[model samples]
Target: MKTGRRLTSYALNYKKIILVALFLLTISVGTDLAGPFIAKNIIDQHILGIESVWNETTNGKSTAEYQGEFYKKEKNFSDNEEKGKEIRILQVGTKFVFMDEKLEFDGKRTFEQGILTVQKGDEKVNYNAKVLTNKELMAFYKLEIPGIIKLLIVYFGLLVISAIFQYGQKFLLQKSANRIIQKMREDVFGQIQRLPIQYFDNLPAGKVVARITNDTEAIRELYVTVLAQFFTSAIYITGIYAALFILDVKLAAICLLLLPILYGWIILYRKFASKYNRVIRSRNSDINATINESICGMSIIQAFRREKETETEFEKLNTEHFTYQNKLLSLNALTSHNLVGVLRNLVFVAFIWYFGGLSLNPASVISLGVLYAFVDYINRLFNPVQGIVNQLANLESALVAGERVFSLMDEQGEKVSTKRIERFCGNVTFDHVSFGYKEGEYVLNDINFEAKQGQTVALVGHTGSGKSSIMNLLFRFYDCQKGKIFIDGMDIINIPRQTVRNHMGIVLQDPYLFTGTIVSNVSLGDPSISREMVEKALKDVGVDRVFKNLENGYDEPVIEKGSTLSSGQRQLISFARALAFNPAILILDEATSSIDTETEAVIQEAMDVLKKGRTTFIIAHRLSTIRNADQILVLDRGKIVERGSHEELMLLKGKYYQMYELQKGNASLAG
Candidate 1:
């Protein structure tokens, strides 16, 4: 919940749209609340208000005193004031009119269309009358059937206006939801960029991808489904309660008990729901990671014939995911939605029982119209409750998703310096640097080294001897546990990683290419490298003949990971890529290991040109390539076991000499 609240802060940025949506939502609720009251008026004023009939007698010639039921102007007038009174009407003239209850004039009168029209000299006046025999008058009182039709129209208009407002609010809410999602995705992506290399080393690619794509997608549901339902339900509940209070304060107060019951249910629901949702989310991430790993390692899996084993593992994770999902489903069924339905029916039963008691009272005044409206309002109240209950499942998933997304965003990464360095000399130094990917297990200890401007330094070592770790340190992919690294005599910690790496380039053991054309791969989307630069760099790598067979040459399409191309061809492109950048410092880690001896020989001169006047670090298992290097460091178990020129190391007869002799024997055998 803490994490969800924090993630919700991003919504504060789009206050304008949210506020407008809320306003529309409130107005919609107001229109809906007007419904039952309009219904009550239709019943009390126009539908059922006419039931009492009057009979009377008077003794006179052509004079009659007709006794009729008295009608009060006020609907709720005190019963104590007048329990029952007959309206007295008598004829005093040739028109045979006795008297009118509400209006009196000494003149001839005639009743037409339920209107008593009186002619007093030249002036004519009209007054409404309750015609006992007229079936057109639907009410006991004064309102006519035409008035009932107009009331129905007004009632329907309120509903139509409510529908319009509801549509507007729902549309605006979803729009705000999408905007909030966009902002969250951007933050997630930006955080991924700043995280340390070890973070990726420890976590799977698919899990991180899930955090950015899947989890954030769930958060979007939070806004569109959960929050939308929450606000709507809240407004509806409030309106129902307000209407109830207006009708009967005692009954309204009694209805408030269900609120705390609902609140407690929600609190309990969240406790269990969050636990189940967490496991569900974790399993989802694991499934994604498993799929990604399977795809990437398909070749190895097929080579080893582990298809059955792979399927078994995937089934385990898939089953675990589904099991937790079932638990959540069961919890939802038992707790919120179905429970609200039961609770709603319970409230309705209680209301009906209470209203029936009031109707039985001889003296107690109770309008049947108000009793119907009470039932209607109570039903309205529970609809929102059931609505909120229906969204509980979605709400649980969204809150869980919010927890994961904000937790990722909260991860501390490499600090970014405000300074941007455009240029720097290529003199690099590592002063007593000690580092480890894990605590207390150092991969490089007290590693002191320097590669001056235009110097070529070679790091030759066995596998797991920290050659790549040193490169990792130099690139600031991981900060050292101790000591400082200097680039052009500037401490690297103070320099932005981008700025420090501006003059450095690395060609990894396995080069990666994005989905693009050959020219784009060489340029790597750097706008500074024009077509001319791309062409020159490709030709300079001495692999132009291989590309010349394609109709588009450098323009030929490169699929993902350059899977269609040979390893040698990919290496040549990567070499061209490094050279095109023209960095002051270049580090090649097994760059030529993939190429055949003949191809290496073909590009040897171009390689020289690429390495010319640049501080270079070459890590290779092949001893022949580094014979001309200015200095060579042989690392054994995180320590530099030997450091000298090839000639100097050969004379020393140490670890370097032993490896050289072994490699030379292998080269002879291969030949």
Candidate 2:
């Protein structure tokens, strides 16, 4: 997967760490092997021996006639005593009892057989009898202190090495993952900023956020878990298998059989995981889209009482996400169950076969101790294999995430400007510029216009009549498909996008205010500008008094999008922001619509001061707002049908005059 490769590249720098981890892991496995080896030594030396012999004895005779008889009645004490004393309770292969010899009893009536009887007259003398019976073949026992000490040392050293390796691996892996996440976030955000406006026109902001945040996180998971685990697990499996083979070829053969079976299972699960994870990711994006819309339009929902409908839609998306998650989980469980079951049964079979073989060959000289150790090794052999198989699904998911992130990164950005424009003036022109969102349906058809320095041009058109499209063209948010737009007698197409945007100032209907002090928000227009300059601009916009009311006037904090302030206040701040830059040209996009009449009157003065000595384009619905323009162009269906002063259009009694009269009548009625 694309994302997988991208994330793996991050680990390239940590190759040395990975190698060290591998070395330490090998040492650890070797130390672990010593455990079974030590166990085998203890068993063979202490529990069994080749040169040992055993002798057993009986104190009474066996009653063959009594065995045929059931429990004949114990008629008297004498008969019972005789029966007990004559019967030999100890038999062949019976366990030996260890105690003092004084505890021995005679075969007759439980009388003491041999005891330290102190005779008064005859002094006690040492009397012994030597007797030989059956000698059974047995093993000798010996304990090695030096070997035990060596085993302990190995265990301690292994602990230290394993700890260091584990800690180091986590540290390096985390650092790598953080760096990759940072890069992914940067790239996704940067791409969004450079993408053309049309790309965002029909898309939801929340979906974009999901990609930048959630999708990128998914990709990060690949680096942190899937990518790293895949590498380490595979290496561990190989190393373990190699060690096992070197230790015992027969046992290793039994263990190696698990490899192909494990690989097949991984392959099967990966296919299903890829399909399900992709669906989960896509649906998560959709859910995010719904959430973004719901939150952003909360006011509208509240006003319309459509909360239930919105919640229903959200639940639908959530359900799909859950469905995808459950399906993937079920597949994962099935894969694990089958793989583990097979490995477990195979391991048991291997142990039985190996041990049975050793038992059958009495002269083979393979000790029971060795067989026990081999059995333990067989289990250890497949642990790393199982680890690799378990992480296979994670690897697949990471691959899917990687592919998505890479696909986004690989998408085409805005066309690059080869021919750079070095100089520019305020002379702007749209020469036969035509453009459309879709083919054969132009939003602006053969549009032509010009604005010289120190001229204010007013575009008067109904909604969708292409007034805003003209502004969009001037800003080069999109290039005109048909014709060229020029700035200062130079084609805008040749000028870099940054150069064009840097020279233009714009105020939209909904002014954006970032989370910061009021002064900072205004000063964002020119970060290098001083706080004093920002205050001066705010004063010029006649918002100085409002700032004075706050505890910290110029430093008054503004919430996101200026939610804490009124519409007029936000517009005034925006006006000051645009003025702070002192751009060569400015465009107002329905900037006065949200402001109240009283605030509009106040900002009108600020607008007048800011508009001087620069070319400006004004788009407004109120005729009174643009009556003072040097020229008014009325557009209809993307065509410029009328151009004149306000009075001149009124005298002609055309479309502009009719709209003006209607608006004037509505104003009078409302008043």
Candidate 3:
């Protein structure tokens, strides 16, 4: 019900179109039932009725009386039922004489144009009376031909009108459904922006993509197929019931008993169907996640020669997804359209037996026309019921999609304060900070650090020593569990995330590049950075030497992830990107880790220019990279164990000094 309500809220935005469709749908359904009713009328009143045989020789009206009412009156009887309802002859000198033998119509009636004839004067009309006996007599009572033509005209006209409205209703519904899908997609994409980083850390990339794209598309089917058909079917069922009740109350009452049985069957089907559908959806998400991972890691898989292993893992996920889909298919086969078909056949069987018993009893008041109409109405009712049953799978899929979409929307993200700070001094302070990425597991214990404006602070340690963790806290990616971080002597926790990150620029060990021109990647599409400025920044960072031979220079197109570029080229471009931003607080996380020794040797000039007036924090494994740092903090097991200049740290011969000696000896051995 909650899923249904959420979908309804999206639908209500386009209610005007929906309401128009509904009105047209009602008209179309009402017109459809008219065909069966018209057939009943032609069978009961026109061809099969006690039609008169008129004698043209007689002048004026012969007073023919039945039930004490004169039906042979010469006046027009089309408007007045009482004056001449028993019989009607519209021509002058017309007389229709009632015969003694009254034969009821036992079969169907077929009408033809320009074939009806009436005997005039004493003309002897020799007709073949032995074979097809009623053919000649049917022509004799053909004086009511004009009235039958009028009824046919009305019936066909209604059919044309019904066709028009049916087309309009379908077209409008499709348009409304498309608009609704667009809105739903927009809302899902917007919700993705508000989710936390940790939320993404737990789920796979492909799973998130499936929810944003594939799942929402499933909901689109809910609007197009399930919604339109379900609404039309409901209206059809109601119209069918009303027609049946008007025909005969007792028969309609018996038909109503089938509702509870149908409802119970639906309940049973949904119980199993929903469960299998959920499993199918979950497996499909897993399949998407696996495929995305495989594609992204294809280069690694091939380089390491793990193609067979990767293929085997992908096959396992695919097989699991396929197995669940088969289970859902099996569930559908047992209890969907087939079940509705069974119920329809049973209803027809019951209808026949009940009506047959009435036909045998002499005291029963029934007509063939009424029985024919009832059969038509019952069939009409079950047709839509079958359609609705067939759409059950779509409803289940849409509901599951809704649940996933809403779950992402409900996740808690960083509380972004509205207060803005356009600029900040480069000063940063960590006051007795203690932090952890998980509950009750402190990765950074009682950490204290400080970097004055325009000073370079270098963090060096072995792996898992929390050097990167300190940068994470400084950038406000994750808040510390205890104590506070201050910028320019003011706590930054109350500042908005966008505002705080605006003055910071980060260049990481592995720089990510989007599909675009090199200049756009360098400037990151910032309008303030002109083309000339992007060029200058690239030159300043020594990236021009790497791509000088490329055709378009900085304007060259970069393919996905910049896969065509060398590792050094990618890292150099990242440096230019950070330099172009000119952030007050600069962080380099092994930023030069990928560059060759010769290229790194030249980029030092660009690095000095970038860190000139900004508070810079360098996280590096190479002790040679931090030789000129104003302050060096050596971390061990989440605590800053030593703090001094590079020369001062070498004198202490502590953990930092030991790491320096090992790397220096390793380089000497390789040379």
Question: Which structure among the candidates has the greatest TM-score?
Answer: 3
- Using TM-score, rank the candidates from best to worst: 3, 1, 2
Model with the higher lDDT, candidate 2 or 3: 3
By lDDT, the candidates rank as: 1, 3, 2
TM-score of each: 0.86, 0.83, 0.87
- After superposition, the stretches of candidate 1 with alpha carbons farther than 4 Å from their true spots are 52-143, 415-418
> Judged by lDDT against the true structure, how good is candidate 2?
0.70
| Candidate no. 2 TM-score | 0.83
Question: Clashes in model 1: which pairs?
Answer: 49-140, 50-139, 50-140, 90-98, 91-98
Candidate that scores best on lDDT: 1
Candidate 2 lDDT tens digits, 1-671: 44545666755656676566556555555555566666676565434422112212122221112212311112222332433321122211233211112313211121123322322223332212222122311111112344456656776776677667666666676666777689778877888776788888877887788788877777677667765666566655676566567657877787777778877877778778889989888888788888888887999999999999999998988998899899988887776656787788878887788766765553444666777777776666556666676776677666776676666667668644444334345788889989887878899988888888878899998889999989988998887889999888889787778778776788898999999988889888465788788878888989964445778777888988999888888988988888777778889988888888878888787778777888888999988899889889899998898988888998999999999999999999999
**By summed lDDT, which 10 consecutive residues of candidate 1 come out lowest?**
55-64
Off by over 4 Å in 3: 49-148, 363-365, 415-420
lDDT values, one for every candidate: 0.80, 0.70, 0.78
